[model samples]
Target chain A: MKATGAYEPIFAGERRKRLDDVFTCYPTKRAALLPALWIVQQTHGWISDEAMTEVGQVLGVTAAYVKGVVTFYTMYHQHPVGRHFIQVCTTTPCNLCGAEGVVEAILEHTGCGDLGATSADGRFTVIEVECLGACGFPTAVMVDDDFIEGVTVDGVPELLGRYP
Target chain B: MGYPHEPHPKETLILSKHFGDAGARSYDGWVKCGGYQALKRALAMDPADVIEIVKESGLRGRGGAGFPTGLKWSFMPKERRKPHYLCCNADESEPGTFKDREIMRWTPHALIEGCAIAQHAIQAEVCYIYIRGEFTEPIAIMQAALDEAYREGVLGGNAMGTNRRIDMYIHRGAGAYICGEETALMNSIEGRRGNPRIRPPFPAQQGVFGMPTTINNVETLVSVLPVLNEGAEWYKDLSLGNPKSTGTKLFSVCGHVRKPGNYEVTMGFPLGELVNDLCGGMRDGRTLKACIPGGSSVPILNREETEACLLDYEGCVEQGTMLGSGGVIVFDDSADMVYQIMRLARFYAHESCAQCTQCREGTAWTVRILERILRGEGEMKDLDLLLDLSEQMTGKTICVLSDSCAAPIVSGIKKFRDEFEAYITGAKQPVAALT
Candidate 1:
């Protein structure tokens, strides 16, 4: 079957070699699927259908199977997200510590206007996430790869400045 | 030790002694602090002996289940037919739990050393520390520590110069709360969707590529090093005379507390004292109204239960909850019980894997019901309907995700019915906007 879109392959050259090396850790070739998908997300910021097909091809699984795994996880963006995707923990623990106000402050400061919507500048995308596993440090936020803890509504502006 | 703060005089620091010290993050610094001594000692002793010593220490899993750590280890096959796997469960996504994160962030070497000892005890050549991807810093810190361990011959073909071959790797998980479950964790490591598998041929018999596998919580394994080093009796005596719940457990205190952080205290410590004295009670003039002593999955505790509660396994059980993961979430009188309960419901509804029909339907419906109650649209009939839905949701799924959704709802209704009734009766204002 011909490829669906103009998707540049992620697992090629050195990246392909890295993916191949990951296979050594697991007994089955299929076991490297999560790492393979992560490599795609890290490189492309989202997993397009064509990229899912490509990952399926590499892992000897169907495109539907790859998409199935991709959609199951919250971190993997199916569509293109902002350059900096910020997930704020607003669960019960964080909520008790005024996480909602922090979310509101982030949505306002990031110019995203709403949760999950990218700002007009395409600089930020903010969303309320479940627990980020740092409950003791309430109102934890993750701006891309950075896991920041003890974030407050008052500090959202200063924090966003550091991000951009 | 209450991390990010001074250790309380009452705290018994076993696994969290080097929490705030940045030097303890590296292998050399850890070595200077007498770090790998437990692993060195374990390498000399028989793996069976190591397992026996841990079993006698009365150490239990800290990942919410409270399963006996040593008992879980002994379940692995005595005669290893296939490659046995040891998975260190570092996927700490529980809403109120953060102790494991501290262990990984600060004492990376201690965890690696613990994994090394565990790998030896379980007769597994390979150990995979499955960490959640959200923990970028902990992952980087642990990866550096693992790299240092390999360079220093602590984890490799000939780990610590021992003839036994042990290889430890990090399998990063994409965001999935269900992946914290042991079976789901194995499925995730296998590059599949993180779905919980049914038990019958449990992980001990067939797990992770259909081999004998032993999965343990981060706190559970790290505590093993101390058990082997200090002898089982000393470790057992660390608890306040609780034979069932030995050793000092790290309780992550958050929410309305004046001082919130990971507090390490001996078993049988009073929950009231930990909240009032150690955590400095509620903020300002607020009084304690509610608490979830364990992770968010457990039942909520009322003020009376909160004050009289013990911090041990049996003590929590007596109060109609479990000392699960030791993540104490405090709530002051200002907290809205009905709305907060709805938020908890929403978390489970969002996290459900949807494999089990009950969890998929029950969690979503529970959230809807709770949201309806929070929106002042609920009637008294809806309360019983919520109870009925919760009853059906419990113990009817492949995993406890559905049961977890039901726990807070059922407990909240039983203990704090007045709050739910007020929402239904329109006495309490609708706080949450319609979704």
Candidate 2:
């Protein structure tokens, strides 16, 4: 969570303006906490302790309060991850299909070797997530921002290649 | 019409009429398909009359509870006292429901029009469509459509020359299944943890920001367009004999079906036909083992009950399940009941917000016991213990999440006692350890 060199501010210049625009949408600055955290995550790969403090300073909330909200939601990454974060749906609907096989294939091919671990090559991180709300397309996987449908075990390599 | 499959002859596609059509995504494309006429009509009519029309159509909420939509809108103060808010619950994360995702991606304007009409009816000027963050494409599509609506005079300070203000924005949910709960959704919108608040002073009385608010599902709001376009009775005629459950519901069918997609069928449609015909039956000659007629929150149905059950509110209740979100998850002979039920419990356990001790403790324990049974390490008394815990979990929380976790367990043990007993008696070998 600590910065390597210097802790540059996240809400500066254009990002600050974007946060300000979102502030107008809400009656209070604290109400923009989720959107502000999203901006931080979208800019940096993940949220850090310093970044949480900066966001709290902007919204007039505390770093501890920001951490509580960030941890409550799963998408807000609290630490660093691989370049491409992969979430495979293993809920029952997908599980009934070959979703486990898909997850296993992803883990083997990505060299992550385990769920929630970034691959040694630092290209991908794989995790078995809950339903992505796309059940008809079983084995729905989200690589970074793109939500791919009907992913099968055999298609793991190609799905990984597209991200890199 | 089903998107992935060819439209079945019996499907009455009112909401999903333009589902797979790429042209309907554009604002002008939506207008060519006779969109926005409903908003114009709804705007001209008295707001109370609009409520009356929807009530006459018998359109209940499609977001699982199946509460009457018109009755819900009526709860908002007769006059606009303060800033009334409209929350379009696009946070669709139920295990088997994806209808709202398609509705937003395919026909964004349909949702926009529905929101505008609803805002006018409930006298709310600002609406926030709280979509889940996982839906990256749908969120972009909706934002683009909102831009179009604003530029084209369909929304803004003077919407379509009506001189009434209606503004809509998208509040992206980071990742929480519990946000699908109405009260939890408001908390999420306010940038707080997604926790379900206890009800008595309902959303209608004191809602988001301490003002009156109303929330509607994506399907429920889109259904508003048709009832206002065609007369209420014309829409009501789509249902089978049950006057209580009218209009076509989009059932998101998945798991072991040949043609898995959203199938729009009139209420009271037979579940057997939906699985056997509309979805092209069980996958490749596998015999039907069981079906979760609604989403995972409701009870599961065995093969015989699945064959005879009707796809409506009253009918699902008669079969000992609620028509929840119209998500039909099919199971074939090869599927394992004990393992799959364990997986469902795990989902609830992971999603529980831990605000209430009963849910936080009960869900985690349910998963442990179910995992034990799956591992062939369970004793006979564990079955009785699970049922006893399910009783305690059912109604003892701020939300029904604990109750939802207990639903499949209680039902699975009742319908497939042999399955659980097989694991306990060491008659069936334990499958590889559950992940």
Candidate 3:
């Protein structure tokens, strides 16, 4: 987990205006925490301590409070990840339908080698996630913003090929 | 967007009637298909009358618990002395349930219209649809639909020129399963960690922003459309037999099934037919070993119990399970019951909020014990120890996440003791170390 240096302000100019617009939607400015965190992640690959402080300052909360909220959620990465983040659903429903084999294939092909590890080439970071809520489509893999369903061992290479 | 299979003859299809139709996602398409008629008519009637019609229809909550939907609405302050809020639980993170995802994807307008009507019924000016963050597709679709609705004057300060303020917004969750609980959802919206709050000050009393709030599941809110459109009697008559459990329910079939999708059938429908006929029955020749009739949170049923189970609130209780989200996970003869049980335990262990000692420790300890047993290092006493731990886990937490972990472990050991015994006795080979 390498830290990308030179932390810059996230809530600036257009982004600050966007956050301002969302403030009217909620009765409290603090309620925009989740959406603000989402905006930070959408801009930067991961959230750092410095970003947390900036977000806290904007939302009128503390950096420690922002950190507490970020760590509680699995989606908010604290450090930089590979260019493409892969979350494979290995919950019971997916596991019952050959999700393990698919995980094996993804690791082997993506070269992530193990769960929660980034590939040596810095292209992929694969992790096993619990229930993507698409149990009907077993082994649902969310690569970055894409929700790829019905993936199989044979389709691993073709699936990742699109990302590269 | 079309589902692979056609609607089975047994499916009644009211809420799912417009599924797979791309046009139904738009505001215009929804209006053309008689969608907003309920909201229009509901605006003309007294809000109490709207709640009464829903109460008369007997439509219960679909997001587990099966509580009466209209009764839940009536809990809100009727005089509107303070600001009232409505929460739409679109965080469909329950393991086996995904019908709400389809609703937002194919029929976004239905959810918005339902929320608008619910806002009127509960006398709330603002509504928030709390959708899980993982649902990027549904969120975008729903956001687009909402923009269309606002542009068309269907929802705003003066909704449809009715002079009633109905402001609906979507609040995205940040990957916490416990937030699906009503109180936790409120806290999450307040920019705090998704920890479930203690009850008895309930949501209707103090909710998001510490005001009177009425929260309902995405499916439960959408079901109100049929009750208002076709009248309460028509929806009440759709049930198979039980008057207590009325109207159609969407069952999400997954696991070792041939044709897996959301099957909308009336209440009191036989589970056997849902599995055998509608789901195309265990592949070609594979016989059913077990089934989790509800979501993974509910107890598992053995083959005989599954075959005899009925798909209703009362019928499911008789067979020793609750109709929780109606996410049926089928297991074929080839499934390893011991390993599958371990996976469910791991899911809860990872999702525990750590606020409650029972859930935080109980879920992790249960996973460890199950892993040890799977690793071929268990005694016969381990089974009893697990049961003891499960008892401690149940009813001892702020939320049911730990109890959810205990359900499958307890039920799995009771129904499939032979499988557990086989692993202990070394009759079954130890599985390879999983990462």
* Overall local distance difference test of candidate 3: 0.91
How accurate locally is residue A54 in candidate 2, as Cα lDDT from 0 to 100? 96
Model 1 chain B: ten consecutive residues of lowest lDDT = B426-435
Alpha-carbon RMSD, each predicted model: 1.7, 1.0, 1.3
Q: What shift in Å separates residue B17 of candidate 2 from its native position after superposition?
A: 1.0
- The residue-by-residue lDDT of candidate 3 on B376-423, one tens digit each, is 897899999999999999998888888888999999999999999998
TM-score of each: 0.98, 0.99, 0.98
Q: Candidate 1, residues A1-164: lDDT per residue as tens digits? A: 23465767788999999998899888999999988988988887888889899998988999999999999999899888888899999999999988999999999998999898999998999999999989888789999999898999899999999977
Tens digit of lDDT per residue, candidate 1, span B1-435? Answer: 798889999888888899999998888899998899999999998889988999899999989998988889899998878899999999998888999999999999999998989889899999989999899899999989988999999988888898779898899998999999999999999988999999988999999999999999999888988898799999999988789999989999999999999999999999999999999999987999999999988999999999999999999999999898898999999998888898999999999999999899999998888888888889999989999999999999999998988989999999899999998898988875563
CA lDDT, every prediction?
Answer: 0.91, 0.93, 0.91
Question: In order, what DockQ does each candidate have?
Answer: 0.88, 0.89, 0.89
Candidate 1 residues lying further than 4 Å off, grouped into runs, are: A1-6
Q: Which ten residues in a row have the lowest lDDT in candidate 1 chain A?
A: A1-10
By DockQ: ranked, best first: 2, 3, 1
iRMSD of prediction 2: 0.6
Mind giving the per-residue lDDT tens digits that candidate 2 earns over B204-270? 9998887899999999999999999988999899899899999999999999999999999999999
